[model samples]
Target: MNFFHGQETLSVIEWILRSVVTFFFLLFAVKVMGSRAISQLRLLDFVMALMLGNIIAHPLSDHRIGLKGSVISTIVIIILYLFGIFLNLKWTWLRNTIETMPIPLIKEGDIIYKGLKKARISIDLLLAELRKEKIADVKKVALAMWESDGKISIFLDPQYEAITPSTYQLETELFDLPRTIIKEGKIDFQALKQINKEEGWLVNELKNHHQTELNRVLLATVDYKHNLNVFLY
Candidate 1:
């Protein structure tokens, strides 16, 4: 019996199985890492991709190792990483330890030099970020935070925000959040009650708008201005 006779056939089968596993598991591993890895590309995300890629390569090139061992090791690492992420999300202490919170770079028109230094953000860089947010003066910024994902969130002083209908000291009623009273030709009586409107009142109002039947109304909402918007199917 030739020593290598049947071994070649076995090697071909092994290669096919390993190829399929490696190809699919790479995608699975990335998904397990989470979507933030794609959108944010935070430090942890980059490290995971690099590490998983390295682990997958060694087994592909070396036929001496069983394909299952390498894949299993990769899965173990992913599981551990995911557990750490879950802890960071659920536990406050672990969250702070694993990922830093948004640092307050500016407060009440004063630059927090201490915070800027801690975040390793220079004055020039901070100014550049401010400019991107279209803030011309730091004095106009009521608050500015350096977000963990490497972006800046700016809250303008009430006076600095753009003029609106009520910006010029004009008296305005309190804004009430709108609620749907009708949706898809069905009356939401529960929503009407939540808005302090009686079912009979809604029917009467709908009649005023020439909408006699709830089944004919496609959409309706009562907004902060006490205005009823109704649309027919």
Candidate 2:
């Protein structure tokens, strides 16, 4: 009891206990929030994160502050956040109000200064984002949108796009992902079974083709054509 909510003074063990309990509780809270909150921070997620951090931080630092109130407050906030997400899905007006529409940062190779002002981003930041997308020249971009998640979506002009096999009407092989048959000098029996191969065949193939022992090989993958690729340690 003292470990959770201390009296006048807390022992080191009590402090550690409080930290461990709070850590796991926060993990459970985050799990309830879902993966979207971690992957992409929207308006609701941002607010929830800030509030939860602030509420939980005080109890961890001050022994006088009990964990019970913070836990209750976190649960209530999480419920409200989930409710907000549900409302956003049900009501179009609420969704539009909370999650702002994508603003056009660039149109027809021209920079939209008004859009930049509205997005509250500087020209240098825009250029930095463009550089990240390997787009050095702004004139090469057909359209660039400022996404709600604070990411820039850039599309190159048709003329600036890279040429592919389809451009010349060339035939191409079908996509075939390689399966890992062995990793870290150990065979993955499941992957071998999926490819309709046995352990003996893999050993023989490695010996005959690569002249390498199974334990010596770091990684081995087999493609759709049964082509064995091996990497050594």
Candidate 3:
């Protein structure tokens, strides 16, 4: 009985050790891989990570390289990922620290070469990219940002700031949002409530516009100018 109990305790201890080591190793590997490993990751990066995980998981899980050990390691990795996601949602600072922040690559129309270099972006390539967008002059750019997700966002200098207002034509109307009255062949009752409108209002408007049936209408929306635009067929 004594020998049996000792064996049981040792088994439990071994499992605990395996779990702890596997968790830490996976965590470190993911972090060291950098934000780009997951964000804007290429096909090769994803494949390599998957292959490495499969190979490394075995020894970490059961102290042996086998299918069962690989399964255990995969489970550990999933748990770690879930835990990290939870913490990221709960802690803003942690999320910010782990994730990349948008860096200002251009400030006051001046390119910050150091920032671009740190991001592994070439100044000549960036300038060429801007030119493709019809932005020929860097002096006309108010701000340029290298987003965390590996996308660049360019903010052009305001019309009046970059060029005189008189040089451009003025538009009389403000940009407006389109309203949806129906979706997926079903009436969106919640949308009607939010818009402070009823089903009767939609029916009457459609009828007034000579639209016979709701099913016949593929899409009906109120444009920014408060004009109803309908599409069918």
lDDT against the true structure, each candidate: 0.78, 0.92, 0.67
> For residues 149-211, could you state the per-residue lDDT of candidate 1 as single tens digits?
777889999888889876667887776778888998887888877777788888888888665
Better of 1 and 2 by TM-score: 2
Q: State which candidate, 1 or 3, has the greater lDDT.
A: 1
Q: Please give each candidate's TM-score.
A: 0.55, 0.91, 0.49
Which ranges in model 3 have alpha carbons more than 4 Å from their true place? 1-72, 82-104, 128-134, 158-178, 193-201, 222-227
Candidate 1 error regions (>4 Å): 1-23, 42-46, 57-70, 164-233
User: Whose lDDT is greatest here?
Assistant: 2
Rate residue 149 of model 3 by lDDT: 59
**Per-residue lDDT value at 22 in model 1:** 79
- In the range 7-113, model 3's lDDT, one tens digit per residue, is 32335566566566557766776675556556664333445467666666545443334334454555565556556667866999987887677888898789998
RMSD to the true structure for each prediction, in A, is: 9.0, 1.9, 10.7
Clashing pairs in 3: none
**Top candidate by TM-score:** 2
Worst 10 residues of 3 by lDDT: 1-10
C-alpha positional error of residue 114 in candidate 3 after TM-score superposition, expressed in Å: 3.5
